[model samples]
Target chain A: MKNRIESKSEVDVSLKDLCKRFGDFTAVSDLTLEVHKGEFLTFLGPSGSGKTTTLRMIGGFETPTAGEVYIQGELANDKPPNKRATRTVFQDLALFPHMAVGGNIEYGLSFQGLNKKERKTKALKALELVDLEGLYERKVATLSGGQKQRVALARALVTEPPILLLDEPLGALDEKLRERMQGELKNLHKRLGITFIAVTHNQEEALTMSDRIAIIDRGRLEQVATARELYESPKSEFVADFIGVANIIRGKIIEDNAGVKKLLSDGLEFFIPSKEGFNIGDNAILVVRPERIEIGDKARKSNNSFSVRVRNIFYKGAYLEYYTVLESSQEIRIRVESKSSSQDTSADYKTTIGWNESDSVVLTREPK
Target chain B: MGRVTVPKRVSLWAFTILALMFIFLPSAYLLLISFEPSELEKVPRNFSDFSLRWYIQLFHQERLPGAIRQSVMVGLLTAGITSFLSLLSGMSYRRLRKKSYFLGLLIFPMFVPGIIAALSLSVFFRLISIRSSMYTVVLGHVLYALPYASIVTLVSFSGLKEGLIEAARDLGASGFRAFKDIIFPLTRGGIFGAALFGFLLSLNEFIRAYFLSGWQETLSIYMFGQMKGGADPSIYALAGLILSVSIFLVLVALIYYSFIRYFSRSFA
Candidate 1:
């Protein structure tokens, strides 16, 4: 099952045909992905989707039941974590409770054969790198949650491994703190310019931090693309639905003419831009992003317009959500930025909503 | 956090006092007689008659010193062996799939009656032609104490997050190095608790010591023998000393445990 490629310096880590089975349950199955050097790649999936197991296989914490892991072009399937050129900031942070901040950071240096004084100097430098300059002697139990997270990062970074694996790195923080750490981590990744493969179930965190997002579902790799590409042009219904809020309209394509395709479902019709591999009379799926749909007066002038009954309007802080239903009784949620004071649609029960043909993508139905 | 009602508070205080008296009254009587100069007198005749005469007489007993030495040796050996084995057992439990079954097997000895266990061990030793001694006493005590020690160690092991070991290994520590630097230091409280359990169990052991000890008697066995052959005031003094030492050790252990707990809880 080993899918080896010619050694390339640009790729830092590669997994091919990776499968892990615990008894009758398969956690990760025949998964393959290539992580480029100096890129921030995230394994994004829902819980129990085998995202963490895939990360563990890359980090050498778990051996794939069948497949090959290559680190820096060398086969790493049998290599223990310590022997691999990778370090992980575990989900719990896993800071050594018995050691002080300096000692925790200095732990990896002990194996490097550095003298105690040199190790202290390097550990202090690493501490300063994480903005905890003077708290070298502080015990882990005395540090706050955010400080402990930074200490975990600093400890893993002190070893200077070529690849850093973060398993839900900010999963333990509060909402406000998590958002702040996301920015800090992105900046840290930029400054270090090393391969950072993070595993997270947070779609927003993945969207904000990752250079490339690999969406995994039920142990299979659904899609791997940039955040913008995944959001705008998802190849599968699963990728489109999992990456963000999407109104997935399932129907059979009835009209294929010029550069547009018309899909009919029940009593309604939808016009979307023609896409490859979708033929007339084929059951295809259409993915329209919530933010891409236009409502009220502006929607009437778009390529595909519909008059829908507005069920409700939700006032989110930065935007407004219009929960509308079409003639066929399908629910559609439209998100419109509330930058102006006149973006209200509460007075009218019937509203027009439409999206440009290019705003929605056509994806083949995922096999049941 | 709820306020206690008057009747409930009063009853609680009364129950506490009664429990304390139930536990300490007999020991208090022995402690009072430990200060008397004469063996026949139950208490000091007067406050001015109180003396350390019996305590001094304790050292003069020929077998008492040897018995104490033998007991201490047995306690130290039992504590060391039990703690080490229990720690290893606790570590293995994490990797075991059928954990409850394995735990039940390890705890089976604790369910056996002490007298029956001691008699069987004594018979087994004789059948093997192994003479009963302090070493045999230690073996029996370890068998009795290991279940308790392992339970304590398992409790501590449970507190250890699996991520810590994985993080250590990710940071380039070998398995042995990870255990030395992380696992042992973090779970030392449970290991120490196990050791204390082994030491105390071996010290207070009577039935197994009575069955396994040959020629030289343990302190408990020696004390029992003295009670049967005209009780000595020195035995009361020894009882008072053992009680005080045990209380001091327990107090020290409690303080140390709380200190570790406090340190661990600040961030948790």
Candidate 2:
């Protein structure tokens, strides 16, 4: 899939070791990434982790202290935002509070020297693209949160820039509106086929919308890959923890057998396929998702099994989350389907938790 | 939940009485004396019949019309010069990091007492051999009003969100164009309010006019001179007219501002 996307188009923008510093603090450090033509790439990170700063540099709002930026394969480090063929939808929307919807959308076109009739036609078309037709003369302040977001999108798209930058555009909306707008934005991206670079901290949002996700941490790019690849095979412990919830069990590699590796924890042994390269006596951790751990009479036949006392049970609508303490004194959380007939029998009998060898992954223990 | 007890509305009534007494008593006294039969007394003994004699005398008094004309001219000149200079200074102070200390120094004159400022300017004018006139009074008033205008504009400029300007630039506007379209319109309210305040301050100024106007007297100076000659009732009538004019101008400004605000909001 990656090769197919790469073969379809060339790169649109490239950042070469981009670095931004403020006094003694480094905001973005030696970052390099490429945004391909007509692809939706998201920079996923926590606040102050340099995602917004990187976007600002690409948008020409902040100059990189070091390195270069290339737009359409040309060096564009010194170019102002007006010269760059990119428009940004700010986090706050930043719609002109004194202008009507049409006026706001037409402002950029007028700067492009378009005639009044031409600008109005383009603005109405752009508004229609965002499903906000006939809202041209409505006051922006009177619009709801989702409507404001659509107007912001129309304002940016009316300029017909090659790239659209969105800085958490749906962050201010409620959950339901955010979900709906996400679908709308994805559909819009598909229809326009323009390079869309978005910045967000929500893991689900990034996984759901982005064609490729770049996870950043502490001013450094940790990993960049497809959403499924990132979630299924995280490159580092930070990526694993950030992408989703997982039970991380500290252990050391005891043996490497053909393609299977055996790891030893406090008093238990586990097996996993050695795909990430592990040797004997190597310190490792076993990352297991809660849904992958089975709790039933069928647990005895699994490759890795352990006895644990059920500590707590939380009832989710679709699944039951069970917090259990293993014999090794480490607490592990497991999720089982809510339809299971097993009652809270921990008071009478001990429970065994198990998972297949293929479901466990050996990860390097991250340094504190 | 326990019942929530609403607080008593004691301060509201107290403030109402205080506001009325503070704002209305002096004007009421002035109006009462302006209709007095005896022109030399401060208090009026009776109000059997109202007459416009004092108002007639006020308009026809010798030198009063000229004083009013000079005051208006000086006030206009002072407001125009002060607002323009302060706007430039304020914009510079807001945009340039190196001008903060300089702005602080420029604002020092506003904190000085009016009497001291007038005295200092008088000494400086004498050294330069510049005779005092309506222009001199205007210069003194400008010195008094410029700092207020600068402060107001500076606050307005600072309150503006930097992202709005960046958004304009990102939309293909040059730096100057962005400032013209975004910054100027957003700060227009502050500019107008500051200019009106400066005009009012200059019109009602007395100390600077007293020291700077060698022969030609402003309205405030003329009124002060009349106050020393047994409190003429015609002067009270003149004061009442000036107060009414100030109130009318303020009301007009308020109405104009509300109209603009409503239009902007409706179309936003």
Candidate 3:
């Protein structure tokens, strides 16, 4: 997945060790991030992972308990939302139900001292920008879901803020509508060239629409990188499990001067081509992506190979995923993908599952 | 979705009619007794002599008329004050960290006995040198109506999405501006309902009004005076008038609200 336009050179928003605590519970802790100008950055995580808390702090809804937030190189920690140069599209769209579509678009301009005529003219222009030019007098309750989304976008954009914060803006829409809106949002971001920082728990949405994704878990930053980098080179077991489906197998590293082997609990040796910062007798976890594993006897194509018993098979439309376990133990899961064109004979039998060292990540685990 | 047994449908209709009759029976009885033609009977037997003879006398009486006027004024003032207080309470309720505790604390006066509240308010008014008059009666009525208003407003606030306010602030509106433009308009229905409830409660209230109103006589006080002076034909006429006016006002408000809603939707 690729963003429509390249992120500009300017740093639009920066956080320096930001922390937010509600009494004894810390919602976001010591988060430092820099969002480039005209970039669409997503904060992706599961519920209660502090992704929303981080976005709310950026939007000035929740003040940081410590540290600071800078927007375009200016301190904005205490600035009220009205004084900030940013806007947000809420999850429910939050269009004023009593107001017409034009009224909603023109709401933010009144505080800027714009005359009514100028406001109306700007509102019309914004509606045109969002492709809702003729819906000035239509009440919000009468609009369709997508139209309401467009109205929300127009409302946020009408103020001409430099950055937009979207807190799960497409969470309420149906799947087909959400996908269409995602495309529209990408195109809108490209056409406007404004920074967009969205917070969502859906990994697919984050991967499909962002220049970079910051994965947060348990009020801490796990990893912040491009979607491909985060998926392929996750630094921790938490990141690997949260980003996508990963089979995390615990083992002990054994070095014999020639090479290193990850000794699995089932007495299988994973021949590691190379690894960093691991000594002999050190516990580690190997994360192999399901799509990267080969489910055949082609051990020459893979750096590390082993055999396991097939436990179950799930038939997805595009591929078949096999869940295999070690012969002596049921702890490790060997997930391998079988495409529709290839016949899979690994079910109900012992089969070899292998992946090259380049296709897996060896992460440090807490020793028992 | 369409499969409904006949017995369930019958039971639902039966329950609805039963509820309606339960609500309307007392009011029908009051209206019928008001047309008793100055008779001493508790129940009206003859429908032939239902007349306005006592109604003319009721209006001609000076004290009763003045009392009704005073009650109306006090009721209106109580409604206004109660609505404003309820608005503040409801907003605070939305903002409070412990909402349930704050809500329970706010409606604490409602749980106490009516006489106890009246006695405590009377003592407090005297200690503050606020003489017992129509203003004090208004104060007491407002206190009596506060819980109803607060409850209604809180319910309305619960129905509203908090995101609207955050969205408004994000759109560059100040806190006051956001509430003035978005929150107030959206919650007006609940406020209106609370105000009506306050007005009706104040109008019917007798215990607190009797104690707090020194020389200023409200409708209930005047009715008590007439009853003490023996059976008065004018009292029935006045009760009938109050009932009719209340019903008419309620009907007018409903019709007017529906009309406004219809037109507002039409414009959209």
Candidate 3 structure lDDT = 0.83
Candidate 1: list runs displaced more than 4 Å.
A1-8, A256-261, B258-268
TM-score of each: 0.94, 0.88, 0.90
After superposition of all CA atoms, the RMSD between model 2 and the true structure is 4.5
Where is model 3 more than 4 Å wrong at Cα? A1-9, A257-265, A311-314, A326-346, A366-368, B1-26, B36-48, B256-268
Ranking by TM-score: 1, 3, 2
Off by over 4 Å in 2: A1-9, A254-262, A275-282, A338-349, B1-15, B42-48, B85-110, B124-136, B150-159, B213-215, B229-231, B265-268
TM-score of 3: 0.90
* Model 1, residue B92: C-alpha shift (Å): 1.3
For model 3 chain A, give the 10-residue run with minimal summed lDDT: A1-10
Best by TM-score: 1
- On the 0 to 100 scale, the lDDT of residue A315 in model 2 is 77
- Writing each residue's lDDT as its tens digit, candidate 3 over A205-238 gives 9998998999998889888899999998988888
Best by DockQ: 1
Residue B134 in candidate 1, Cα distance off native in Å: 2.4
Question: Which residue pairs collide in model 2, if any?
Answer: A139-B268, A140-B268
User: What DockQ do you compute for every candidate structure?
Assistant: 0.64, 0.46, 0.52
lDDT of 1 by residue, A247-284 (tens): 99988887645645688877688887867777878888
